[model samples]
Every structure is written in C-alpha cells, then in structure tokens.
Target: MAVGVSGDDLMVRVGPDATDEVLGRPGARIFDMTGRPIRGWVVVAGSAVTEDEALGEWIDEGHAFAASLPPK
Candidate 1:
C-alpha cells in the first residue's frame, strides 16, 4: 500500500488487483485518482453486510482510494 497526502485528504493506493476480501473495511469514500467513485468500496468491517447492504455490494474493482487520518 502506498499513501500520499494532499492537503487535508489522505490519498491511498492499493494493489490494482485487490479483492473485496482484502479491502472490505469501512472508512470513507472510495474513488480513483481521477476522482471517479468505485462501488463496493464501503463494505462493512465484519459479517454485518446486511446492515449496510448497499455498501456490501462494493467490489474491489479497479484502482481504489480513500481519505484516512495520519497515525497518532
């Protein structure tokens, strides 16, 4: 994983072929460098997909990115 910081947003770069099983954790918006949203990027952390059914369908397709806070 590669991380870049742009102002107040955290830019993340994960493996291109990453699967849902690898990035099924919730955080914030998932999009590409071009600013296009990628569906299935907001999967629930655990098996509680039903609670967020819409987000559960997020597949780790294409390059994915998200905003994150710097480690404290």
Candidate 2:
C-alpha cells in the first residue's frame, strides 16, 4: 500500500494531506491511469529517484501515510 512500481516509475501512497506538496516535487505527478487522477497517490520519475536517499524519502512518506490510516 505504501510503494509500488509501474514500468520505470515509482508509485507512492502519500495520502491526501501531502498530495499537493509532493506533486510540486521534481518529477512527481498525479497517478492517473484512469480518466481522473487518483488522489493521495503519485508517480515519481525514475530519474528523480536515482539516489538512494531520494528513493528512501518517498517510500518513508508513503509509509507514514499508510500508518496513519485505521487498521483494516
């Protein structure tokens, strides 16, 4: 639920609160497989995540958001 991969892109579940902010980041975009974008989810370009720290930060954001949700 936190992180995924679509082709070379990195998918992250950052939740609604951080969606806007994350979208402004380099190579970040709304995850839009359907006609409309899926809120709280983002696709980060592989180029932007070439560094280990950058990749970790995004995954951490996703983990934080997922952790905030109520248990299933």
Candidate 3:
C-alpha cells in the first residue's frame, strides 16, 4: 500500500481489485473494484456499503482513514 498527499487531492494505491463499501457523506463518490466512480468523493472516509459486511481492502482503508482521524 502507498499513501501520498498533494494539495486537496489524496492518493492511495489500494490493490488490483477493490470491491468494498465506502462510508461517506451524501456528496461522496464511492469507487467500485474497477476504479469506477460509484459516487462523489465527498469526505475523507465513508463506508461504501453496510457495516459488518465483507468489504474490499480498498474501502476498508478508507474507513481506516476516517477512524484514524482526530475528529472534525
């Protein structure tokens, strides 16, 4: 995994395939496994899918990011 920060854009090299739920506000975009824009990229982290469900590693990383933060 790789993490890079530039301006207001964040980049994370997830994996070959990512099919997980991303949790975010209503304006967020959740990308599917094939890197397709499932939704708008709103906040830092948002579970793409429901909790407790098996999430793709990429989406998990996004959740982790939100969890790791120090709150708003």
Candidate 4:
C-alpha cells in the first residue's frame, strides 16, 4: 500500500490490495479495491505491472480504477 499528497486539493492513496488482480501470474494482477484486477483488456502480456502515483500517470490509473468500483 502507498499514500501521498496528489496536489493542493487531493491526496492519492494507492494500495496493492486496494484492487483485484484478474490477470498475470499468481499474486501478480491489476487491483481495484479488493486487491484484484479489473475485468477489462487493460492487463498487458507481462506479469509485471505498474500504476499511477500521487497526481502522476500511475496515480491517474489508480484513481480511474478506484472510481469505477462500487463503494465497499
């Protein structure tokens, strides 16, 4: 899990266990809120993956994914 200031108005929180991983190797998946990957074509071919970070690209990806999920 990771947390940091996104900007003057937002604080981004990224957690590996935040989302669900549907693809990739064991324990290597795209997360949502339950540390799992999404059901989409976003997962790449490799087992390694990366996401957004505090107002950056990675952060954007994480935010979008988070928003798509239902409140849990």
Candidate 5:
C-alpha cells in the first residue's frame, strides 16, 4: 500500500499525519475517487514525477508511512 497508479496520477500513502505537508508539495493533492477525499493518501500529478529519483522519493515516503502503521 505504498504507491499506486490512478490514471496518470501517482497515489501515495503518506499517512494522515503528513497529509498537509504532502499536499503542500508541488503537484500534490488529496486522493478522491468518489467525491470524498481519502485520508492518508495523495495524488501527485504525473508531470511532477518525471524523474526517477523523484518518483523513488515519493514511493519511499509512502513505504515509510505504511511501515509506521500497525499490521492488520
């Protein structure tokens, strides 16, 4: 549950605690599939992740956040 692809956007599981900061990043926005925005997730514009390093960074953030959560 680290990252996902939604159309052309990159979905990141950044956790609710970091939602505001993540959203403040360029091309970042709350992920919304059914009108309501999902907590702990964000959709980054495809254009923002053109660089491999940038993409990796986002995925790392997502992975880190996911790791912080308790296992089901």
Candidate 6:
C-alpha cells in the first residue's frame, strides 16, 4: 500500500509487514483509498528512504493494468 502525507506532495509504498510500524508513527495522517482521512496508521520518509527513490510508489501489477484500456 501507499502512504501519502497531508498537504505534502509525497507518497511511499511499503511491504505489508512494515505497514503498521510506518503508519503508526506520529506526525503522519493516514488516508483511505478515496483520499479520506482515517486513523490507526503510520508513515515514513526522507533521504534515508533510499539512495534512489522512485517518483512515486505503486504496485507493479496495478501500474501495468492502469495503462490498459477498460473492457467493453
């Protein structure tokens, strides 16, 4: 899943195992799939994220299918 910050233009996707820890931290707000505010989640980011980070985070399969045309 992806974590997005409120009023900040950044998002991070982490493994299922790290979801709770990441979103459970302070100073971060969790949003639902519809961009609605929720609770009980964590967040993590910064240069420490990695030597090189992608423009955005997304599931490989989700990205692949996003570019395809919808079925009639």
Assess every candidate by TM-score.
0.31, 0.95, 0.27, 0.27, 0.93, 0.31
Candidate 5, residues 1-72: lDDT per residue as tens digits? 899998889999998889998888989999999999999999999999999998999999999998988999
Predicted structure with the largest lDDT when compared to the true one: 2
TM-score (C-alpha, index-matched) for candidate 4: 0.27
Instruction: Flag clash pairs in model 2.
Output: none
Off by over 4 Å in 6: 1-9, 33-72
Top-scoring candidate (TM-score): 2
- Kindly give the number of clashing pairs for every candidate: 2, 0, 16, 20, 0, 7
Q: Candidate 6 has what TM-score? A: 0.31
Pairs of residues at least 3 apart in sequence or in different chains that clash in candidate 5: none
Indicate the residue-level lDDT of 60 in model 4.
Answer: 65
The Cα RMSD of model 3 versus the native structure comes to 11.2
**Per-residue lDDT tens digits of candidate 3, residues 3-37?**
33334433343332432333423222333436665
Give the Cα lDDT of each candidate. 0.39, 0.94, 0.39, 0.37, 0.93, 0.39
By lDDT, is 2 or 6 better?
2
Residue-wise lDDT of candidate 6 within 1-69, one digit each (tens)? Answer: 334443333344444344555464333334454676444333334432333333333333223333343
Instruction: State the lDDT at 2 in candidate 6.
Output: 36
Q: What value does the lDDT take at residue 66 in candidate 5?
A: 86
Give the CA lDDT, 0 to 100, for residue 6 in model 3: 32
Task: Estimate the TM-score for candidate 3.
Answer: 0.27
Candidate 6 contains a number of clashing pairs equal to: 7
Q: What is the lDDT of residue 42 in candidate 3?
A: 23
**What does the lDDT come to for candidate 3?**
0.39
